[model samples]
Target chain A: MVPIAYYLVLSAVLFSIGVAAFLIKRNIITVFMSIELMLNAVNLAFIAFSRQWSQTTGHLQVNGQIFVFFVMVVAAAEAAVGLAIIIAVFRARNTLNVDQIDLMKL
Target chain B: MHLALFIIFAGLCVAGALNLLLQRHPINSALSLIVVMSSLAVLYLLLGAEFLAAAQVIVYSGAIMVLFTFVIMLLNAGKEERTHGSRLAYIAGFPGAAALLGLLTYIFLSHSATFGQARLGEYLATTDDISRVLFRDLLLPFEVTSVLILIAILGAVALARKEH
Candidate 1:
């Protein structure tokens, strides 16, 4: 009796939160987290739609799930490289505060 | 009820995201993000995307979150920022958050009228069917993902290398 719309709405709420956090947060780590939040929100919507259509046509609709798998793999790689970059930046700057990082202006 | 489960998962996801943003310590933030990822995997399972649920847990929580935790530990982040909370941030952050949530509610409510409802059981195909479609139809993206992963690995190494 679960409705796909419920899942979609939940995903939308998450996505909006991510967007707001990404735009407003000052800490670099917080911003990175917001990006991950957005990606997860998208994955939720994918799975919801996949389920909805599968039950309608009765043909094993796993494409959305497959896409989710790929997204997760890519997200892992991204987090690794992104954290490395953040580490390097912290090493050079001595601060993770976003406002203080203005080195490109020179 | 299924609605209750949806509410629980949604609450968990939002709570985790909020903790990630509000926690002063990078390590705590990293842990909260992992919680978010795990809850998302649970939601995926409920949605009948078992493969996605497994991948979500393995990749996001197991691998990516560990990397984030390691980086935070390595950097010793949030060691000096003793003062974490701010009254000014509460004023600005909460209003913006509330506005966004309101917008989402409006969108979903309006869209619900036009959105097509499909029966979920009709789409149940075997894993072989999924595998076949993925390999045959999505071959290009699959190969591209491999290349992307390789590049990410190389980039991480380059970033970690000591300067000569």
Candidate 2:
């Protein structure tokens, strides 16, 4: 039996890595991928908590998993719209570098 | 057995994430993200969310990643050029991430007893179980997501369409 804490620790580590990647990576697509990574990490935590509740209550609790399902749905929608915007930005600016696409930067 | 499986997949997942960060090319990064997603799907299975494990694989690895790869190829994205980005970002980002991880790890480890242990196969959330909740209890949100998807589709089409 794995301690639920272990799963939570793993999720935290993955999320921190995602945050680092999000901040450090310059490519817009890589940044987008990091966002996905963060979402995945949160989903893992949600499931871990769900399992913990089920273990303590002596029944299966589906709420956490259900939240994860909705998160996935939203993530899918976000990816579609985000990639399209990325494409449009690429077409207009002709580069994917975040630093160079600072038209709105003061 | 379950602990070992969890360690292996978790290690793979972290490695894939690090690879995604280190790789210079977007395509390479995309491939590593696929690796991460696949390992995550395995982790979901270990957590006894069988349906989510399948969905993670089919939706994330199969559908979303393919879309990413297609766009990467379409744009002809190249290896990222190194730039000495703002010094503040470099100084703040890594340490900030480490601090966040340490804080979370400390909290979880210190309070491990509250969370309890998760033995594999003890409590499985079958597809039938999940769908019942989704359709009956969460039916409104479920249907709303369909509308959300439609809006996203329209938005994507509008954004990506060529401007004559």
Candidate 3:
């Protein structure tokens, strides 16, 4: 039997991996991807929790899923804007190496 | 049946994330992320979050991934740039990753031992329930937040535009 705890644990592991990748990766695009991975991990936990609690209500109490929906929406908007910024940054500086973009230094 | 499908989707998601990490090209990584997103959507469906699943497909796989692909294509980021980081990162990264995983394992184990298994019933909280709360109770805030996000999006685009 697959316990909800198992799913939640997997989700947490995935989220931690994403966070590690996000922090360690220098590639701007990869960092963006790590963020997406983290979001997906959270979504998994949300769905798992929703299902685990859905047994008593006869209907599903899936507020977590709804929260995931909002998260996805925000993530989409964030991606669009984030990529646009990255694109612009790449134009000014020929490299997407995040460590090299020191434009703020006096 | 549900467990089987969940396992399959979960495996696919994990595989896709690993591939994204190992792939040499940014485009390949983006594609792998899409696979991960799609698998997550399937997992959402299996968990009976139908609306969420559809939204996941539409938002993440559709809009967000498309944006990522376009950006990757625009940058023309080659394997060389992708791998240009310091060797120091790998040395430090491995231990950091290990520590995070260990911490997570500890937390999960501790929580698992004590967490109560709460049982909700059918129609516990559906899309309609969310709609009722969102549209009826939180309508103004919802609209305001949307407008705020839209403005931020436009502002970001404008700021990102190259000056003549």
Candidate 4:
């Protein structure tokens, strides 16, 4: 049996890694991927907590998994819209570098 | 057995994430993201969310990653060029992330007694069980997601259309 804390710790580490990648990576696509990584980490935590509740209550709890389902749905939607926006950005700016795409930067 | 599996996949997941950061090209990062997603699917299975494990594979690695790869290829994205990023970012970002991880780990470990252990296969959330909740209790949100997907589709099409 793995301690629930182990799963939570893994989630936290992955999330931190995602945050670092989001900050350090200059490519817009890579940054988008980091966002996905963070979402995945949160999903892991949600399932861990769901499992914890189920273990303590002596029954299967579907709520956490259900929320994960919704999260996945929203992620899919986000990816579609985000990639399209990325395409538009690429078409307009002709580059994927975040630093160079600072038209709005003061 | 479960602990060993968990450790292996978790390690793979972290390695894949690090590879995503280390890789210079968007395509390489995309491939590593696939690896991370696949490993995460395995972790979900270990956590006894069988349906989510499958969904994680099919939706994330399959559908979403393919979309990313297609866009990468379509754009002919080149390898990222290194720049002397802002000093404040380098100084604050790495340590900030480490601090966040340490804080989360400390909190989880401190409360481990309450969280307890997660024994594998003790309680499985079958697809049937999940669908019941999704359709009955969470039906409104479920349907709303469908609408959200539709709106996303329209937005993508509208945004990506040629200007000419």
Candidate 5:
């Protein structure tokens, strides 16, 4: 059995990488993916804690696992809509570069 | 046995995530993110969340990432032009991120012993187990998600339509 701390630490590192990607990436899709990565990392932590808590209580718990399901569902919906929007943006602006698409800027 | 698997998969997961960041092209980054998700699924298996591991593979890496890749191909999103936007961002951002990672690691390591090792075959939430609560106690959210997906499809069609 691997220690729970290691899982948490791994989750944290993954989350930080996601953060760095989100901050550094100029492409909007990559930025969006970094957000997904961060969500996955959070899901890992939730499942790990859920397992730890479930074991301590001497029963199988379903809360954390279930939340991960909802997160996936939401991510799917977001991706569909977001990609559609990205297509629209590309059509209108002719570029996917975040810095180039500043039409909303004053 | 489990520890070794965890170490290998976890290392892959982190490396894939870093690669996702380092890649200049969005498609390359998307591919690397798939690597991260697959390794994460394995880690999820190690943690005994078999159902989520499968979902992570199917929904996340399979569906969402495919959508990302398709968009990249459709739009022909070129490699990002390297912008020397600000040296301050590098001097500031890298250290800030490192500090945040260090803080999180310190906190996790300090509290490492609070929880015990998660053993396999001990998790109670099987698919049936999850479905039971999902269909019973959490039926509303499930229904809501379906509706959300429906709305998302409609929204996508509307948004991606020609301006004619």
Candidate 6:
């Protein structure tokens, strides 16, 4: 039997890495990918806790896993709209670098 | 056996994420994210989330990441240019990130006993079980998500179309 806390640690590490990438990366798409990383980390935590709770409660509640499904759906939808916007911005500005796409200048 | 599986896949997932962070090309980063997602699906399977493992692979790696790659190709997003790091970040970022990681690790390790050891095959979430709860209890959100996906598709097409 693996300790649930191990899973928590792994997810936490992944989440922090995602945050670091989000802050340090300059390209918008990489930053976006980091956001996806954070989402996946949260999903991991949800599934881990769902398993833990099911183990303790003996009722087998799958609410957390179901929520993971909803999160995935939202992620897919966000990817579609977000990448489309990125493409549109590239067309208008001819670049995908975040620093270079500063159109909101005073 | 569970420990071995978790260790290997978790290592792969972390390596993939680190690769994603290090890669300058968006395409490479997307590929690394795919690696991370697939490995996470394996982890979900270990946690007895069988259906989520499938959906994570299908939706995230198959659909969402493919979309990212397509946009990267369409945009022809080149390698990111080297940029000078701010002095504050150079001095403080490394220590801050390390401190965050250490704190999280400490918290999880300290609470390990509160969460009992997870036995393999202890609680399997079957597809029927998931469907029952999802369709019965979460029907509204399910329908809303479908609508959201439809709207996203339409919006993507509207935004990505060639401007006359």
TM-score of each: 0.84, 0.98, 0.85, 0.98, 0.95, 0.94
Which segments of model 4 are wrong by more than 4 Å?
none
Task: Give one digit per residue, the lDDT tens place, for model 5 in B1-164.
Answer: 88888888898998899899899999999999999999999888887788888999999999999999999998888999876544666788878878988998998888877877877667746789889999999999999999999999999999999897
Model 3 CA deviation exceeding 4 Å by range: A55-59, A104-106, B82-96, B109-126
Off by over 4 Å in 6: B85-99
Please give the clash total of every predicted structure, in order. Answer: 17, 0, 21, 0, 0, 0
* CAPRI-style quality class for the chain A–B interface of candidate 3: acceptable
**Model 4: how far is A59 from its true place, Å?**
1.1
Better of 1 and 4 by DockQ: 4
**RMSD each, Å:** 3.7, 0.9, 3.1, 1.0, 1.7, 1.8
Residues A1-105, model 5: lDDT tens digits: 788989989998999898888778888889889999999999999998888888788888888899889988998999899999989998898888887887776
Candidate 1 lDDT over B5-92, as tens digits, reads 7679879988988777677666777788888889988777676665666777877888777777777777776632433334555677
Those runs of model 2 whose alpha carbons end farther than 4 Å from true positions after fitting are: none
The CAPRI category of model 1 is acceptable
TM-score of chain B of each: 0.79, 0.96, 0.82, 0.96, 0.91, 0.90
Q: Alpha carbon lDDT of residue A94, candidate 3?
A: 84
Candidate 1 per-residue lDDT, tens place, A1-106, comes to 5556777878877887777666556667767878988999988888877776676665567777777768777887788798888888887898887767777645
Error of 1 at A65 (Å): 2.8
Please say which candidate is ahead in lDDT: 1 or 5: 5
As a whole number from 0 to 100, the lDDT of residue B44 in candidate 1 is 75
In DockQ, how does model 6 score against the reference complex? Answer: 0.73
Reported per model, the fraction of native interface contacts reproduced equals 0.52, 0.81, 0.44, 0.82, 0.85, 0.79
Q: Where does candidate 2 clash, by residue pair?
A: none
